[model samples]
Target: MTMTIKKQNRAAFLGAIALTLAWGPALSFAESVDDKIARAMSAAPSDVSAEATIMDVDGTILREGTNDWVCLPGVGLIPGDEHPMCNDAVWMKWMAAVGAGTEFSTDVIGVSYMLQGDAMVNNDNPMATDPNDGGVWVQDGPHIMMLFPNMDMLADLPRDPFAGGPYVMWGETPLAHVMVPIEAK
Candidate 1:
């Protein structure tokens, strides 16, 4: 009887595995194009996101826009988090550089909106994966980020996020940018 019970349990487990394998792809693809666009639009103001291009994490263009902005599903090293962001042209190049591990420099100012907030990340190191590695980690809420051509402009801004208001993030790195918080985290 024990052997029969064990066999039945094995069959049940196999059935469960089969069901999961059959339904996984279908469930993953269930998110519609309209849904992706809506999620991407949540990153910025209605005026900017409404006409901005909506792109997915895999560079799939869900919606083409008439403006110079590109909205994505998320940013940073956080896993499984959907912190969408609306980025202007320069920010896009910055992101591309970050993704490719290449040097990035801009001659003009850049802007990125994350009104929906953002995931936790190291303030001084963009490549740092572990938050407890002696780096200042911050999870900002409803913020706008500005990138400058001149690094000297960031010399006076505070680097501490707890200091409140605008501060410098990744201050010691080439990817340094100003973090302007619009609301409390």
Candidate 2:
């Protein structure tokens, strides 16, 4: 009876330790907005001469920059099918450095410039009623903007006030904006 009890206690202690070790990385993955922004900026190109700015929920500018892409770090940009707008290669690199594992939803604003290939394609998601088609394609110029919400104030506001505008414009030609959510490894 004594030997059995000793073995059970040892097993329980080892299990607890194993569980903590496995979850340690995930616990550290919950990063702050500032950390994410810094990571994104570090990955961005220095010679492009673009700017990055982070805004608060009240429309106040928290941080601004003069660089290639203005990123909100962990935020996503949704592009419509009509006018795809973004460099996928560059975006992928940025997300990778920021320790992926973030969730971003698409909010399509509107459909301007009625061209032949500019018609919005509906992916049949009723929640996305806007003509922008919820970030399906890249040709749809600056349609998607990443949102960084103030967690404390978000619950009290009647509507979502964290709607963010585009930070980076992918040159002259508006390709498709692809906001791929990265999972933290």
Per-residue CA lDDT of candidate 2, range 1-185, in tens?
Answer: 10111223433533332232221121124655555444434423433213544321111233654432333222222221112122121332323222222332223222111111222333223124366545332222223322222233223322211123222222111222222212211
| Model 1 pairs in collision | none
**lDDT per residue as tens, model 1, 3-56:** 111223433533332232221122126778777788889999999999997766
What does candidate 2 score in Cα RMSD to the true structure?
19.0
Candidate 1's TM-score reads 0.81
Cα RMSD, each candidate: 15.7, 19.0
Models 1 onward score TM values of: 0.81, 0.23
Q: Judge candidate 2 against the unseen true structure and give its global Cα lDDT, from 0 to 1.
A: 0.27
- Looking at candidate 2, the ten consecutive residues that score lowest on lDDT are 109-118
**Model 2 spans with C-alpha error above 4 angstroms:** 1-33, 48-51, 55-60, 67-69, 76-185
